[model samples]
Target: MFSNPFTPIFGGKPDVFFGRDKILELFELAMFERGSDERLMFITGTRGFGKTALLEQMSIRAMKKRKVIDLGPDDTVEQFITELCGYDEVVKTVSPQANLNILGVGGGVSGGSISKAKHIGREKLQPLLLDFCSKNKQGLLVTIDEIQKVSLEDVSSICNAFQMASRKGYDIMFAAAGLPYSYDKIVQHTGCSYLRRSVHEEIGLFTWDEASDALNEMFSGIKGLQIDQSYLDEINKFSYGHPYIMQLLGYHLILCINENKPKARHTVSEVELKKAEQNTLLAYQHRALKPLLDEFSGQERKYLMKMSECLDSNRLTATSDIAKALGTTQNKLSKVRETLIAHGIIAAPERGKVMFCVPYLADYVKQEAVNSSVISVARQRGV
Candidate 1:
């Protein structure tokens, strides 16, 4: 049996881990080539492909050699700027009373004046980043996850700061992680030169070999808890090698197998495994999916109901096919797809093909849409 070494947010190494062989290699390359102009790296994946785990590893590395300014989405531009200044004197010198009108710290503003001032604060912080990195030998690693949440206009300033830091021989590296589409969106929103400064890495599901190796290592120390090859393959098939789900399922299995109950055994059958998977997946849907489903409009709900069926069958429907499925034209489907992608419901990999971002949603949609009982329940409640 394997145990979870992951935090709730999927940070840190799990008790068992696998895959990311090439990613660790890239980190070595980045470390070896530090202080170069090409310091920024964009790591992208869907919501649960272990982006946070990779970031946590990098965070440890950054702490060893430099200072890491970790910024979450809620950090204000003023707060961001204040931290980047590095000098307590500089922050103290900015007279708190001098900018009281523009500063909505205490909150009393409906005008664009305060909003524009906030943008300026973020934009002007670029030079400060360069100065701080130049003055300090510890260097700076700024990692902002879920960067798609930030406005495009604001991303431009952040990118400029990273570029400036790189040019000035400041080992200021910017590593951002977000959904798959964020790379193109960022490039389109920023200029060409700015785009040229960073490298991009796409995180995907783990391979069979990687999953096998991870399971082997995790259970190696435990007696009578070895995994069969067939069972391992089934786990991979069900998880699709998605790291978060892989670890999660592994965690529950270990817990169940280790229990002192009369039925306790180190082995879980295929039937039991499926039950575990379904229960875990449905729990996630109940917690995270219900709220988002409630927010959908009638048209969005109908389109998604159809889309869910397609994804459940592992079918990637093109724009035209999806339109036909929804009884709408390609242009209309395109608009709905964009909205779904933005809301993190459905995903469009390249152009036309679409699938659910969440596997459970795909299954739930199919079940709910096609089942007469579910439809009767929906009608009873007027959903």
Candidate 2:
């Protein structure tokens, strides 16, 4: 059996990760620049827009000339410093003649050694990193994923430490990825003001051409499968340029076609395509829509349900129409609109017209509304 070529899950980098060449180039340039502000970047997008994948790719690129450190929301400054100081390269750079082990000391450095290093204060750790970077002639690339989950105090401490290193002419870079709400929170912090200068990149929808090319490439090497142009067109339209949806549709379509015939050349039919579409829709409802809706506030959810109700045949609704549906003036709804737009949930197609940024989300919202009513009725009847 031929293995599936597409990666349909979040954070899984495909063998051919397409449609991000421009951003990758920008990151590469930053990696080579010693003190460029571009080295610090903040990437924001809705869930499944490939923020984590992009960060992973950037880390891979930076590893050639710099030490790369990966941090998460729960990581503390002490843990980070201990990890950094224990690196073999950092130890060699900082104490060339000390015969230090992996823990920055001799006698085969143990867990206790790292524990002690973790207690080392910021005042001391800062100079230690500077000496290491200065001696090794290589910078450090620190990437923090899910920035929103990290506390403000930890963020401030990390930023201050990097700022101190920058002042002393040591090369250091910071890159973080998060949803728009989290990214906004980080920027709003007064102590972490240095982030204000970092380049902000918003991941947007992919072009049809990019999607088609990726699908074509994924199908090319398969021995006994050929997809029709019409099928590809349907998949592209169904996916609506969201990367995760594209993978989902492709995965389901392949399975739909290959289910009866284990190994044979086959041309996809409308029946098979429709079956795949149904499966993909169900998968998306549970995997994407339900969790996404849980993240919104009550008012935001109300506003989105109103907008979904107002969707036209073309999948777009006027802002005025949505406002009227919500029984509010457009001015009153402006902040909610802005919030949704910033989080990549919805987009303005033109003046006065708005649509869900993720394709098919409006339908999902409507389905949720129906489900909610059913639940309410069931509770009332004590069923």
Candidate 3:
């Protein structure tokens, strides 16, 4: 029996990663061309849109020609310098004692011995970074994932430093991934003004062709498992090319096909496919959609609930209907629409229309709405 080929873990680098060849090509070109405008790339998207996975992929390629350092989402500007302290080039400029302390300092401390040794403020992050970059002839690639989770102030402090470093034309590159909302907020900040010019890559839904090719390649190696166009069509339709859903459906479908049988026909059955679909939807509701709902504001939630009411068979909703239901003008809802679009929750397919970008969002909204009504009625009845 073949081990499950689908990688469902968030940010887990899949063995058969696909649909990002164009992006990888662009990044490689940026690396090869000195002072290329595209060196600083920011990938943004909703949860599980493959931002973190893409960052990991870039780090793998960047390591071959440069010093690559990956900073976790919570790591602030201070941590960036502390990471620099571990390097020989930067250590030469600082006291030897600081080098020993850098590794041992905990979260309570800010900057540790490196901060005391250099007396450098967090805003001056570029100087040490530049020094390190100057020494590295092959250049340095700094990749950070989920940057939107950090405070904008912390983000800007580092952005200002990076902007200065980039202006100086040092051998340095910064690639970051985060929710799309932060891109506008960060760029508008005075401290991160320079980031307005940086590259923005949205790791979004895959095309049908991209999704089909990926699924075909993923299952092709399994001798005991067999799939054809019909299975592929069902999986693609249900997943809608969302990377996370694609993985989830593919994983569950494989399990359903086998059904713990000692031996069975490799071909997929309708019963198995239906079971997989049910499992995928349940998993999506809890694992994927719940966190997103938590992030929604009251108004945003209301907007979505209202939109869900107006959903057509095609999954599209009219902006006019939403505005009318909300007792607001379309102009008033424009900002909400823009926010939803940025969040990857909805798309405006054409003039005066918006569509839920994720599969089953409409059904989820309806269920939540019904539950809310039940709670409201119980409260009134004092049951």
Candidate 4:
């Protein structure tokens, strides 16, 4: 039996990832080009848009010529420096003659304590990285994922370190991925204001061609299973160019076929495709939409529900109509409107119209609202 190649997991890079050629090109330029301002990059997008995957891929490329440091939301700048200095590979690259432990600590190098290094501020860390780059003749790559969860103070500190290192002509590169709100916050910080000059990339849905090509490639070479062009088109339309949903649809479609006969050659039928589509929607609702909706505040959810109520046949709801439905003026809805737009949950298509950024999201919101109301009624009636 052939394994399913589609992966719906967030940040999970499939065996054959596609549709990011331009971004990867930019990343390569950043990694190799000296004095390139693109060395600092900020990637922002909605959930499941492959921001983390992109970062991971860039890190893989960077590792060929640089010491890559991975940071998380809870990591402070001091911790980052400590980890970098303590990394065995970094230490070996910098000082090849030094005999160090696995962590590059506790050897013949000034007591070799990571705890001692942790207390060093940017003033000390910058020189260390500069020295390493000077010796290894390579740069440093620091990748931070989920930037929105990081604190402004920590962001300031990290950016300061990079800025100081870059000022000394050290080949230091920084890449961060986060939601729009987090990106906005970083841009607004005075200490890291230099990021405003860095390359800002907004990740969006895959193009129709990109999505179709991905599906075709994933379905190719599977034993005894052939998907017709019409079925492929249907899957693409149902995915609506959303990368994660496309993966889900492909995954479920394969499962739908294999459930009947795991090891047999079979032509996929329209009926099987339809069932796969249904299962994909259900999986998306639970795995993606529900959690995304749960992150909204009461007021944000209210705005979404009202917009869902006003959705037209084209799936676009006028901002004024949403305000009217909420019994508020458009001015009063500005905050929620901007918030949703920043979160990539909705887009202002025109001067007066807004739409769910994800296809079928409006329908999901409506269904969720109905389910909530039903549960409320049940609880009130003690059912």
Candidate 5:
């Protein structure tokens, strides 16, 4: 069985391991220097790059000296405040008031979900957090995961809550993690003017050596398992060191080893492992990639196809070359860059370098382009 060493190392935050040491170190430094203006550290990364795992790790670290409130994605301000105020505890601890102004259950109020979150505003939520911090009398760390899913109004309220708690001598801190664009999304949503004073951190991929070591460490923990360096190198190459892929490959290798018992000396055969990896990758591509392709428009699909063709040269393309390949103006391509980014298809790593977020999709695109060309040649011959 694949023991999932990353789970224990990351504490089941999901998609958060294999890399991100520098960011983690900086985060700890920020926490140590708590009460500074940069108490709110927003960690951002691509999908499956382990943003949640980092937050869960932080939550575990904070649990030693602070209280943790795991905020859901769609929680309203009222719901948030109630949770923050320990409403569950209050109903169980304090007066038996049956007439509490609950928003949803039994329809006690007259506001929609958005309205409900806005209702708490800065005033109501602020006091509850302040009181909680005052009573706890220890460092309070409110780590919000998937914070991007929360509405702009709610995000603003969260930023405001941090500001209010900090001003009141409350040893409170905030750590939020989300996608690469989440920081800008928060800033745009929360225009509370205080966010400008917060710190930001970006978590990126692992280096080749780091990724190799991680795979070795991960495999060594599994009982009756001993993978050779050659097999490990092949797995790393196929996975591109993506954390989720690393886990998925690890999971499948264990299954293969257990099944192919004849050749299961100490490690599984690479040939069977490759087949299993292909199957797993196909399933993932079906689930994630096909849907994204279906959502693309004719022009967008063309642009992506061009990107694949250009990137497959194993070389990066300039915007001008990308424009020529797509037969579109650079301005039009520029306009759609944000859309492609939002759709999570491609990313510009540096100012001038662009590549597919999922390299397999680029491969798929290349195959499809070849198929289309072959079909065109057949039609020409028939004519």
Candidate 6:
């Protein structure tokens, strides 16, 4: 019923961005400071952890000092060169030599256009990238989101280009972001060794104070929008500092509040909040939790299920207890525990204990198991 300021969709820039000042400070210093190793950084986090949103923020800052090109899964360096060649900054310098101008005039582009980008480390991309860095006073910044989904073909070319640029001291910088395991997977490929040595920062959950400030500032900024401090605390508990979940919860809460009070002029009611919580959980389960669960191995998932079963009131579960529930020894579950921790799915916050980093994961896993059991029983009875 209200125009929601929160962006619940993945990779969207919310109206009021939450805290990432620490990371942004480093990014700014790297952007402006020469010989700073943080220039090429990688942000790693699980799904819905706001890797893409952070990249968006970096690009905003990057544009002031560098030419920013943000790429998604479908984008390629060939398309990049084609576009970059015609851009005002580059066209003035390289337009005559670039094939982009030739294609539109009397002559169409030759097969070399495709062939050039396909095979790099030769003379295709590296040359143009070097040229751009040379001609433009402000360097070029390339940010790739969902790096895991980016093709090896494209990744190699970009890596080779930037590697050359970095060695030559040309003003060039690149940043990538993806799932927690994405770095491990990509670096194994040939010519990606630089990523292994580059700055890698793991994006984690929002701290309580950060979430609190974001909630208060976001709500107070909206005209005639008021949520009681108690409900805000409830929201903090529900969201548990996960970025995307917070956005979804805020959006649905605002919606329910608007529906309950016409003109959005009153403090929200308990009934409205109850409905909003339900909507938030359902949306989080489908949009975030499901995809995350789908990525894990069977043993890892079983570990999570058993761990959820043994979770204490504080949401902390003992590894030994989970191992017992799984009919395995504590030693055998160590690998599974570490795997989840490495993926940012779980954390061993205390000695011999683990907790779900994402909120409602325990409940979602239990509910998913119940749904699967219901389907299995229905199939057996042919109902």
TM-score of each: 0.77, 0.85, 0.86, 0.88, 0.80, 0.84
- Range of the 10 consecutive residues with the lowest summed lDDT in candidate 5: 110-119
What is the C-alpha lDDT profile of model 4 across 32-76, one tens digit per residue? 788676788999999888888888888889998888888887755
Worst 10 residues of 6 by lDDT: 113-122
lDDT, residue 338, candidate 5? 72
For model 6 the local lDDT of residue 101 reads: 36
Which pairs of residues clash in candidate 2, taking residues 3 or more apart in a chain or in different chains? none
Provide the overall lDDT of each model, using Cα atoms, as 2-decimal numbers: 0.64, 0.78, 0.79, 0.79, 0.67, 0.80
- In model 6, state the lDDT of residue 123: 41
The digit string of per-residue lDDT tens for model 1 on 1-383 reads: 34434322444455444677676666656765865433567777766677767766676677887887776656534556767663353534444444433333543433333323333256467777776777788777777777777676567777677667666666666677776777778877644257645678777677777876766665564555556778777777776666777766666665555453423236556665666676657655564455557777767877877765555344665666668887769886667677777656676775778876665676666565566577788999999
Ranking by lDDT: 6, 4, 3, 2, 5, 1
Model 3 segments more than 4 A misplaced: 87-120, 262-265, 378-383
lDDT (10s digit) by residue, model 2, range 1-383: 44566677876666556677788887888777765667899998889888888888888888887888888778556667766666443433433234334335344343323333333444456666676678766778888888888889888888877888888877788899998777778888997888988989888678999888776777776777777887888888888888888888878877887776655666668988899899998998899888888988887888898999988999788999988888889999999889888778988988998888876778788888888999999999999
| Candidate 1: residue pairs that collide | 5-14, 5-15
Work out how many backbone clashes candidate 4 has: 1
Evaluate residue 141 in candidate 3 and report its C-alpha lDDT on the 0 to 100 scale.
88
Q: What is candidate 3's lDDT per residue for 282-381, written digit by digit as tens?
A: 9989988877887888889889999999888877889999999999999998988898988889988989889887777878988888999999999999
Instruction: For candidate 1, give the lDDT.
Output: 0.64
- 3 or 5, which is superior by lDDT? 3
TM-score between model 4 and native = 0.88
- The better-scoring model by lDDT among 2 and 4 is 4
The CA root-mean-square deviation of candidate 4, after full C-alpha superposition on the true structure, stands at: 5.0
lDDT of 4: 0.79
Lowest summed-lDDT stretch of 10 residues in model 2? 110-119
RMSD of each: 5.7, 5.2, 4.3, 5.0, 5.5, 4.9
Question: Which model is ahead, 1 or 2, in terms of TM-score?
Answer: 2
